[model samples]
Target chain A: MEIALLLIVGGVVVGTFGSLLGLGGGVLLVPLLTLGFNLPLREAVGVSLVCVIVTSGASASVFLDRGVANLRLGMALELFTAIGALLGGTIAFLLDERLVAGLFALVLIYAATTMLRLKPAASEDVATPTGEGPTGAPAPAGRLMAGLSGPNYRVRAPIAGATGGVFAGTLSAILGIGGGLVMVPLMHIAMGVPLRIATATSNLMIGVTASASAIVYLLRGGIDPYAAAPSAVGVFVGAAVGSRLAHRVDVRVLRVLFAGVLAWTAFLMLRRAAGLG
Target chain B: MSASRPGGTLEIRLAQLLRIGTYGAVILVGLGTALMVINGRSPLDVAPPLDPSRLVSDVLGGRPAGFIWLGVLLALATPTARVIAALRAFIRAGEREMTIVAGSILIVIALGVVAGTAGG
Candidate 1:
């Protein structure tokens, strides 16, 4: 009973921070379960996958309702992501836990750097009209790519986006993340998608990407129902609360503090990987 | 482009589906956790290994783990359900390219299932 309460509270904290920071709770969740709760790394990853799915389901709809998520583009890229997730899920079971930990530490360091350097950019950038011909019709780049073009912006370098999708999916499965850090930048920078659309579209793809690998974890008995149940429920509640409070809170200080915490956690994870912890 | 309109019928329907799935899973999982605590089981106890074949039977018997597992399954299924809904919408809209894209995703998920079961 006490442990269940603790897990729920811990999940709420992780969820709140994740939502506020725009990093999905899974990034915090795996570390919490492994370092704080002493759960095995693989099981923690499995549980994190479950939580990521919950977050995605809860938030993706709102983005869709706001017309920020690009559904056609999301679905198109998801094909490659799902494939990569399957491959990564399979590989996760084959790799050493320590190596996974090392990779996770690297991801944490990267996340910390991103958080420290975070800036409030205007979501509505001037659209680069790359794929359109005269008279506002699509250029002869074919119908599929043309269909992916948004009202204000035409998707550019789709091939690069698709390639990034595969990489993001692989890391998501292996590290139990939603891969927003990868997808959001890839879409906004490389694919010419607006920042708002990129974030929303990344949210749309995350659930499906996590689901592909989650099924593998489920089939392999990697997830623990007891831990997953309370944590998932708590995260769902916390995320709802956090997103509601997002616009009101000034997160600059919190982001810096959180980045420091993440760096310290990364150090501990590296030590654990070396059997020094 | 007609089919790709933002906040279109398809997006609305997809949103509704996701909301339902999220709420339903949360309820089931929450209830299952309560049931476990009431039944004198520690939530920290090592969970029994999942047996896919017994999910229905366990749920019918009112096993706490069964409900929890079912909820997890529901959560996992939500995304796939979204994809399926999108695929149907695309097909109904006569979106040939999108239909192919959605169908290919399903195939990929199916392949993942195959690999998982085979490896497990």
Candidate 2:
């Protein structure tokens, strides 16, 4: 009873933070399960992956509705991400758990450091005014359609997106973190996608990518349905709330706090990897 | 070319499908969890191994844990459905490239499910 309650509350908190920050809750959930609950890393990861799916399912729809997510780009990128997830999921069972922890810690540290950087200029600078619009915001003109809306943004360099997808998918599977931490940056910085569009599109792809690996976890006996159920439910509710609150909050403040949390999580993961936790 | 609308018809449908699927799954999982707690069965650290056949049997057998698993299965299926929705939308739009992309993703997901079931 106590464990079930704890997992549900923990998942809600993680999901709120993740949705606010454009992450998918796995980054926080993995460390929480492993360090706070003292579950095995593999089991923790399985639970985290489930949470990621819930977050994706809960949040991506809103993003797509708002016209912030480019579904066409997401679908194109998912092919690579799914392929990478397959390779990573297959390799996960063969690798040492400690190595996985170490890699996850490194990713956390890298993410935190990157978050300290200012917003990318590409989001604001590349304003090719295709037509006049309200607020004088240049309407993006392109043939790359997203759903029924005619064109979203013109996607460039499919090869670059694919390459990034490979890395994102591998990390997502092995570390049980949503690949968005990497994909958002890759799209925004490397592929010249707008930040909002990048995050939303990343959200859209996460479920498919996680599902690719989650199937392996489910079949391989890594998932604990008991742990995952409450967590997933909590995340689903929390993501809905967080998505509503996202616009009101100051993102910079959240970023700073999240970076601190990431740093601390990295330290805890490293400690566990060293057999000290 | 600029977008003709705020959200395309396909995007709206996808959003609606996802919202319904996820929220419904949450309700089912919540009910199942309540049942478990009421029955004095705690799923704390137990990882029950189940195949699809066993899952059906258990659910039909009035097992609360089965409902939980079913909820998860429903949640997982949403993504697959989304891919199919995208494929249909793309084909309708005459986006041959995008239709192929969605189709490829569906194939990958199918392969994963097959391999996972086989391995288990």
Candidate 3:
């Protein structure tokens, strides 16, 4: 009972930071369960997947209702992500536990670096294209490309975005992440999507991405219901609170603190991978 | 860029569906945890293997694990449900391209289920 309470509290902390930093709680939850509660890494991953599903589902609704998420773009990219998630889920059970841990540690380091360098107010004003139509819109492109365009920006380099989606989906399944860290940048930079729309669309996609692999974990009995239940509920609550408070908080300070946490967690994960924890 | 927005209704409906799923999951899972605590069952104990066939019976029998498992499954199903909803909307709107994309996503998820069942 006490342990369940602790798990809930831990999940709240993870979810709060995750929302504030625009991350899935899995990045923090997996480390907490494995290192703090002494759960095996695989079980921790399984639990984190469940938590990720909850957080994504809860937050996605708000993004969608606000009309910030681009459903067509998300669906198009998800075809590739779902395929990659299926492949990664199949591979997860076959890999060595230590190898997975090591991979996760590396991902954590990368995530930390990304967070440390995050510039939320960077240039979002994408320049208009040369071949402008009479109404100042970019020249009509292919059907799919035109469908992906938003009000303020035209999606570019879709092939690159789709390629990145596959990689992000694979990482999401294996590491129990939402892959927002990868997808946001891929959409914003490589695909010419605005950052706000990219983040919202990524939120819309992560639940589907996580669910594709979570089904595998469920079938294999990898998830612990006892651990998953409280943690998921906690994340649902924390995410709601965080999203509400997002505008009031100083995100720059939060980013620095979260990066520090990620770095420390990555070091611990490395130690565990080396059998020294 | 396109002149008019696409899939606006789809987004609103999907949002409602997602909200229902999330809230339902939280309630069911939270109830299950409370029941476990009340029954003196340790939430830290090794969990039983999830048997999909027995899910209905376990829930009927008021097993805490059953509720939790069901809730987890519900959460997993929510996103897939959104895909199905999107596919239906696209088909209704005569969007052949989007329908194809949504259909492809469903196929991928179906294949994932098959792989998991076979591998597990």
List, residue by residue over B31-101, the lDDT tens digit for candidate 2.
77777777776656475665677877777876777888888788878888889987887787677777788
Q: Best candidate, TM-score-wise?
A: 3
Poorest lDDT segment (10 consecutive residues) of candidate 2 chain B: B1-10
Worst 10 residues of 1 chain B by lDDT: B1-10
Residue-by-residue lDDT tens digits, candidate 3, A1-277: 8888888898888877766555778899998988988888888888888888888888778878888778889888978888778888889998888888899899999988877776765424353344353355445488887787877677777777788889988988898888787887778766767666777788788888889988888888788998788788788888777766655678668778988988999999999899988
lDDT values for all models: 0.82, 0.78, 0.81
Worst 10-residue lDDT window, candidate 1 chain A: A131-140
Tell me the number of clashing residue pairs for each predicted model: 0, 4, 0
Report the candidate with higher DockQ, 1 versus 2.
1
Off by over 4 Å in 1: A20-22, A118-140, A246-257
TM-score of chain A of 3: 0.91
Which residue runs of candidate 3 sit more than 4 Å off their true CA positions?
A120-140, B1-7
RMSD of each: 3.3, 4.3, 3.3
Misplaced by over 4 Å in model 2 are A120-153, B1-6
- In the range A1-277, model 2's lDDT, one tens digit per residue, is 7777887888889988888766898999999888888778888888788788889888898987887777777877888999888777777877888888888899999989878784645434253223433345443344443231224344444566799898888888888888989888887665556666777788889989998888888888878887788888778877887777866777677878899999999998898788788
Supply candidate 2's per-residue lDDT for A192: 56
lDDT of 1 by residue, A150-212 (tens): 898888777777888898889888989887767876787667787667767877888899899
Q: What does DockQ give for each predicted structure?
A: 0.78, 0.65, 0.72
